[model samples]
Every structure is written in C-alpha cells, then in structure tokens.
Target: MSQAPQTAQQPVILTGDRPTGPLHLGHFVGSLRSRVELQHTHRQHVLLADTQAMTDNAHDPDKVRRNVLEVALDYLAVGIDPALTTIAVQSHLPALAELTLLYLNFVTVARLERNPTIKEEIHARGFGRDIPAGFLCYPVAQAADITGFKAQVVPVGEDQAPLIEQTNEIVRRINRQVDAELLPEAQALIPEMGRLPGIDGKAKMSKSLGNSIPLSSTADEITHAVKQMYTDPNHLRASDPGTVEGNVVFTYLDVFDPRKEEVEALKDHYRRGGLGDMVVKRRLEEVLQNLLAPIRERRTQLAADPGYVFGILREGTRKSQDITQATLDEVRGALGTFSFDRS
Candidate 1:
C-alpha cells in the first residue's frame, strides 16, 4: 500500500517499495503499474523505502545497499518517468523524521499495539511472541511519511485498507490534539487486482517467502520460476478433476493474461480434468513471457546505466525536500513547536 495523500485537484500520491531485493512481477501489478498510470493523472512521489527496510533488516546493510539502485532501475525501466514522477529516498526526507517525533505523542502505546498491520506483520514474522520497538513504532513513521507530504490518495490493495485507516486516524488526531488543521487526511486507491499471489501459492507473493518472480529475472529465470509454480495439489492424475481457485497458475493467468475468453476456457478445461498441469503451466509461461518481455528488456538497458538511475533518485529527493520543508514549517507553527519561544 502507498502512503501517498490524495488531493482534490490532482492529489499527490506517495508510494514506494523496499530495497531488500530486485523488483518482482508482484511489484508491477500491485503498485508500480498504477504508479505509472497515476503520473499523468495526479502528482506522484515514489519513495524507495530503505529506511523502513532497516526496521527489521537493520543488521543487513549489504543486502539493502545492493538492491537500492536495482529498485530505482526497475522504476524507470517500467516507465515511471522521472520528469513526471518525484522519486525520493525515504531517509533523505528529514521532515518525515521530524513529523514522526510529534506524531509519537498523539498515539498511545496501546494504540500502536492495536494496529492490525503491525499485528499481522508480527505474526507473519513469528515476532508475535516478541516485537521490536522500531517495528511497532514505524507505523507512526509511515503516518509522518503520508502527512509530511500532505498526500490525498494512496494506492493500495483491499487487504491493506487498515493501514489507510491508521493514516487517517493519525491525521485527524493530530489536527484535533493541536487544535488546528496542520495535516491533510488521506484515502486509498485500491486497484481491481488487489494482491498478487506467490509462485508457491502461499497467499501473497513476497520475497521472504521465496515465492516471488523478481523483475530483474532473466528469460531463463522466468522460465525456471514458472516451470516450478504450484498448481492444484489434489489433482495428481492427468484426468483428475482439478481446481484453479487457489492454484497459483490460474491465479497468475487471471491477472497477467488479458485474453479473458481463452483463460476462462483453460480454467474450465482444468476443472473438467482434461487439461494437464504441464500444459497450463506452459501456457502461463508464454503469457508471462509476453507480458514481461518489454519490462525485462527495459530493465537490462537501465542496469547498464546505473549512474543515471541514481541520478533520478537524487533529483527526486531534491524535489520532495522543497515541498516537505514547507509542510514542516506550517505544522510547527500550528502547534507552537516552532521557535520564537520566549521563555
């Protein structure tokens, strides 16, 4: 989900992915694709959230540092024009940190505990038994990221609606606590295709789960990944009545392959038991290869000019800094947090 704010007149959209690995197909359908679409429609700010990545993976700078450029390259290669989009490094926006400090006071310790996103994450990471302070409080940081930019619309999946609620609560609470409207409330932009599934068919597609198809993957890598994708476990025989409801193969086809009639026919064939899993997988591979060929080719070209990608991020940070600075000024002034303290 994006932390961006939606405005009345082309509200600004703020969103980004972490740098733990290269961009994957999940990133494209889920967020990046919409980001490019929103460029001409709204004011967009794309953040490479290396800071948030540090919350849990703080110990691994090597992994974080290596993928930083890769993420940016994926952004540009996928058609996120730097000219239209403001690309910023998360940590570079110091106003966000400053805003976080103020927001921390408005939210209680119990409130943070009740956040559904944090709870799910804690459970997902097996940290339910023990949660880190940074991991818990970063939601407030995310609140700051949204309010600092005064974003109006955040693109997100239905599953991530709770995060949007949290952002809005913070926005309202901050305005009420300070007795002034210092921040802008934001909403969500949920796309038709909510969350992408993993190749292993384990719910959502994530890198940690090892069930992802990375954007930086070569044609051969794509071939390998699709060939091994999980299908209906119950259907073992060639003529066995198969299911595609939860199968990763059909789910992928539903999202990537636009030919509705053909994909549906394939699904029906599998349901009736005549179609083999191999045939479906092969068809899926063909569909994915066609869908990803352009993206892969573009990523290759961007990778060759790494310096240019970094330059885009640097320039984006510069652009974001200007607006964030103004927002900070107004926020501090509203709460008497700014200097001129004659005590």
Candidate 2:
C-alpha cells in the first residue's frame, strides 16, 4: 500500500444502477442528471450492476441479464455520453469478484448484518430469517466496484452514506495492515434531490410498485401517470385549498420544473384554494414531457441499434478490466498469492 501524490488529472468517480428494471424519473432526479454534468469535470465510470441485482434475484437471472442493455440504454438516453463515461457490465469484471473475495476476509458477518442501508433493504424486501448470504455481502462487492476503479468520489443518495463509510473502513483496515494507503477513501456526492417519491406518494419510486414513469415512457404514459398522482385527499373540489407538503405532484414539479417563480406562485394558488388537482397535474405533465422527450427520442434511436449499445459495454468492460487488474495485482502482492516454486 502506498500514498501517491495527487496528479493534475481529473479525479475518478464511480456510480451505477442495478439492472433490475428500466430507470425512471426518480433516477434522473437522484443521480443521472448529475452524472451528465460531472463527466466533463471528472473521469466517470458507470456500472450496470447485474451481479449486485442477482444478490437477491438469483432465481430470475434473465431479469438481470435482459436489463443490462436496458439500463445502458437509459444511461445513453439521459445524455450520459459513452465517449466521456465508461459504461461497464458488473459481471463482466472478474477482477471485482476477486477483490470482493479478499475484502470479505477482513469483514465480519456481524458487521454485514449491522449495515443500516442493507438492514433497511432487508426489512423492506421481507427477507426476515431467510436472508441470502450474497445479499448480506453486497457492500463488499460495492467496495470492490469503487476501489477497483480507484474512485475518489461516488455519487449516491443520502441513504447510501453508510455503504461508503463501510467501504472506507475496509480501505483503512487493509491500509493499516499493509502499512500504506493503497486504496483511496471514497466520498459520497449526494444530489440536491437525493430521493424522489413515487407518483402514488410512496417514500421511494420503485419498479416493483409500478409507480415509476420510465425515461422511455411515451407522452400518453406520462400523462396517465401524472393524472393518477397523489395530491391532498381533503382538497376534493377545484375551489378547495390544498396541501403541497406531501403532494407528489408538487414534489415532482419542484425537482423537474426550472421555472422556480412560476411553480412557487402556482403552489401559493393551490394552497389558497383556486387551483384544482387537474390543473396542477397538467403542469407537472407538461414539465415532465419536456424533460423526457429528448431522452425518449434518443432511447428509441439507440434501442434500434442493439449491436452498437452492447459494443459500448464490451469496450467498457475491457477497459475496466485493465484498470482493475492493476489494483488486483497490488492486492495479490499485499496478501500473497498461490504458487508452486522450488527455485
């Protein structure tokens, strides 16, 4: 392990999404939008986490495999330039698997069970007494993903802070044993809208809940989703005053609508009792349509060329292996490797 001097080159950033389903508006508000801007200033590596998704979905391997392309399509559609961002498939990076295996030796089962984010997810998924070993150990895989790329920054939601902390802990522990800082400690880059609610007013927008509006959704689909969005139940009539605090429609507008003054004024109108749910829903629909139109167009164009999309992943995976191999070699040297020598 060693502490190298900082270079003039841009810092590395690692961020990714699981290939469980198509990405939605919540993804855009949370991380995708920031990734587009960050690419110009940093070296970004986006991973389609097929292996991570399978931690719990092992029975549905096809789901994870199919969405590798879907998730990549979502990335390309969102203005994440493949030229600027290296998009790799997680399972394709065998070095990450090797790294995970080594790190697991340093971490304990009790610590894995105590991870706040993983605990919350476990309870949410109702894993109960039947939690899979792989699911509980995903944070190790995540550490591999970050350190494999030598990422100094990881863009994620506030809820994922613990995951980064755990990664850093592992890094510190290994560095202390090796007497050098071979791996970089990654920091969380939380977005302004770190988490977005579902259209149905759930705490999170999830594909399983069917509350998400995909980036590739048509105009009609956006309109339909917005139409059913949750608003104040007490404000039954057009003339009744409404609450915006928990209203999903207003929440979407606040995140997506750039017309700050206009949205503020509209909120005031709704609170004062002249605005109807239909009116507010229409505004949100229009705002989202404008935001998603170009993305949908680009997704359509790219989806037509499956070969081109997968080719990007192939190239990215090759590049990712090259970089991660350097780190893996260092790890092997630190931990010692298997060999047969009688020299």
Worst 10 residues of 2 by lDDT: 1-10
lDDT of 2 by residue, 49-158 (tens): 99999999999999999999999999999988877889999898999999999999989999998999999999989999999999999999999999999999998788
Q: Give the clashing residue pairs of candidate 1, or none.
A: 4-14, 5-151, 5-152, 5-153, 6-151, 6-152, 6-153, 7-11, 23-215
Q: What is the TM-score of each candidate against the true structure?
A: 0.92, 0.95
Give stretches of model 2 more than 4 Å off: 1-8, 339-343
Misplaced by over 4 Å in model 1 are 1-8, 128-130, 340-343
Best by lDDT: 2
